[model samples]
Target: MTEADFAFLREYLRKRSGLSLGPEKRYLVESRLTPICRRFGIATLADLVGTLRLSREGPLERAVVEAMTTNETFFFRDRVPFDLFREVLLPKAIAARAPQRRLRIWSAAASTGQEPYSLAMMIHEAGAQLAGWQVEIVGTDLSTEVLEKARLGLYSHFEVQRGLPVQLLVKYFTQIGEQWRLNPAITGMVSFKPLNLLQPFEHLGQFDIVYCRNVLIYFDAPTKTDVLDRIAKVLTPDGAVLLGAAETVIGLTDSLVPDPQHRGLYRQTAVGRPAMTHRLAAGF
Candidate 1:
């Protein structure tokens, strides 16, 4: 890839998805776009960029977004958040929102849908305990292609194993050819959509629990603050927001207060104090 090709990709991705690809990730850009270049019959990355510039809204642009946004994810990528959901968050949410029996959950960076599906399975296991509950699980990603795949709820064996409990796997998934298809009951539980966090959030309603894990690290501090602020706006006043274990809202934004009991959990606080510092205990 030439400097011109790199410049095109950097600007296009930043404009379309708010993802910044630094010079060090040049290999990543080449690796991701080689097939694209081949498919378009372009001899070089620069040629592909020229073709892309001339093209309007069509499959080419969509392919670029998909290739750049594609990420590796699997069932319950992190165990602790699900554990907290079952043991503490769900119980508290269910009790607090009892009369309404309404709960909304969002997996903001939900790649291929495993996190939301895992959540739906947890709720399904609760059964009559939540018989009257109106549970809404919404999973959104920047890539529409990935969102469609997530809605299908089918996973390869390797994809199903990462952080998923053996018992739940046996109960909820059925063998189909080489892949395992999640029970429709589980896939049917979630609603998937294309949502870019870097843009202003619109149309989508608020939620009681927002899971935006492992995503902010890709963004700059200002983008993180903006995304976090937008997330806080749609969250219920007392709702909880969960980020990746290494991610924090303390110094990144002031709209959240860290939950001492829950790692990566933040309670919506009024916007004013953005410099708070925090330290996490190991294995939380």
Candidate 2:
């Protein structure tokens, strides 16, 4: 692809999806979009860009954005985030919502349902302690394709093998031949939606915990700040937001501040509530 075509794609993705593609990432663009060109019978990336320019908001445009957005995720992909949820965030949310007995968690970058499903599994493991509480998990992504896969709650053997404990796998999943499907009880606990973090999301309602892991790294500094600030508006007064292992709120926005006790967990300072004093809970 010529520099002009590449620049067009970079700006297009950044505007629509908040992705910042530098000049060095030309290969990434070419490799990921080449298949789309073939599928559409377009000759090259430049032709693809020309078509995209002519047909904004068409199925091809949507497919291009989805293909470029990284959706790499697995069950409990990183141990620490889930541990933070079970040990610190969950107990904190449980205590905070005891009066209303309703708790909501948002997997903001819920790629294919693993994170939310894992949380539902943990809540199920809570058993008696959470018996009477009303808990909900909503998983949202920019890609409708992945969201559909998530709705099905189906996983290949390789998918189940990644960071998923065998015990929980056996207990929560049924083998469908060589693949595993999450049980209805766990699958039904969560709802999926199509969301663009670059857009308004307050309509989704306030959440006690928002897991925005590994999603913001693709954005530029300004986009990161804007997304985090908007996220603050949808957080419950004492709600927590979790970032990816490599992501942080420091120097990004003042709306959120890091939890003193955890690495990736953050709470909204925009609400004027005092920082939560976290107590580590039992193992999951």
Candidate 3:
């Protein structure tokens, strides 16, 4: 790809999805978009860029943006976050919301449904603790293609093997030919939607927990702060926000602060101050 081609594609991706692609990612851009070029019968990367420049809201634009967005995910990824959920976050949320008996969790950038489904499984494991509770898990992603797969709740043998324990697999999944289908009870607990984190999230309502993990690394600092700011508005007063292991709110935004004991957990700073003393006493 030429300099002009690279620059146009990079800027287009940044504007469309907040994906900050530097000059060094030229090879990545070329590799990802080559398939799109063939699909559209374009002669070269330059041609693809020319076509994209003409129409920002065209189907080609959506294809290019989806091609550039990384959707790497699997069940129970990076175990610690889920561990924190089961042991600390979930119990605390349950206790705090016991009076209302309602709980909501949002998995931002929920690719192919594994992350949210994993949360659903955890809710199932909680059993009687959430027996009378009204629970909802919302999984949102920018890619409509992946969102459709997530809604289907079907995984190949390899997908189920990654980060999924054998006992839990047998308990929650049944084999259909070469693929495993998650039980209806687990699938019914979660809902999938198409969302762009760069856009507003007020319509999604408030949640007790928000998992926006492993996605901010692709964004510039300003975009990161903007997305975090929007998240703060929809979180319940005592809600917890979890980011990727490598992501943090420090220096990015003042809306949230890291949990003292948990590695990836964070709480909205303004509302969290009064709860800090109580959280410490509860060993959270």
Candidate 4:
């Protein structure tokens, strides 16, 4: 792609998706858009951009966003988060919300549903502890295609094997041809929806825990702040926000404060903080 074409597409994506594609990302755009160009009957990236410019409301624009959105995920992509969920977070959350009998968890940017499914498995393991508890797990993503896949709860053997513990696998997955179908009991625990981080999210309702990991690294500082601020708006003040191990809240935004005991876990510290005593008392 020419410099001018690159600049135009980059700006277009930023405006539409809140994702900043810097000069270093030029190759990424080229590699990802090449197939888009061919699929749309365009001769090159320049032609594709021209088409997009002429018809912003067309399917091509949606295709561009879908093509650009990254969907890298695996069963328990990073093991620590899952371990912490089972060992610390879930136990605390269950105890604290016991009287109220309701718990809400959101997997923001949940690609292909692995994270939410992993959470469901943990909750299932908790068994009678969570009985009569109103548990809701909502998984959202920018790409509708991936969200649909996540809702289906089906994965290829290779996909399921990556980062999945053997015992859990045998208990939760049934073989279906070349892929593994997640147990219905586990898959039914989550609800999937399409969500764009660039937009307001207060309408999604408040969450006790927000898993927005592995996504902010794709945005510019201003975009990151905007997204985090919006996240803070819907998060329970004492609720925890989990980011990727490589990501942090420091110097980026003041919407959250790191949990001293947990790596990559940040508890919302804004005014009117919700009671975390229950979670703390549970040894979470």
Distance from true location, Cα of 261 in model 3, Å: 1.2
| Residue 161 Cα positional deviation in candidate 4, in Å, after optimal superposition | 0.8
Which segments of model 4 are wrong by more than 4 Å? 271-284
Worst window of 10 by summed lDDT in candidate 1: 275-284
- Compose the digit string of candidate 1's lDDT tens values, residues 41-134: 7788877788778858787787887798757777777788888899989999988999989999999999899889989999999999899778
Candidate 2 residue-wise lDDT, 55-172, digit = tens: 5687889989998999899988788988988898888777877888889899999989899999999999998878789898999999999999999999999999998999999999
Score residue 13 of candidate 3 by CA lDDT: 92
Best by lDDT: 3
Per residue, candidate 3 scores C-alpha lDDT tens digits across 134-186 of: 99999999999899999999999999999999998999999999999999999
TM-score ranking, best first: 3, 2, 4, 1
Backbone clashes under 3 angstroms, per model: 0, 0, 0, 0
Query: All candidates' TM-scores?
Result: 0.90, 0.94, 0.94, 0.93
TM-score of 1: 0.90
**Tens digit of per-residue lDDT, candidate 4, span 52-147:** 778557677888988998899988888888888888888888778778888899999899999999989989988999889889999999898898
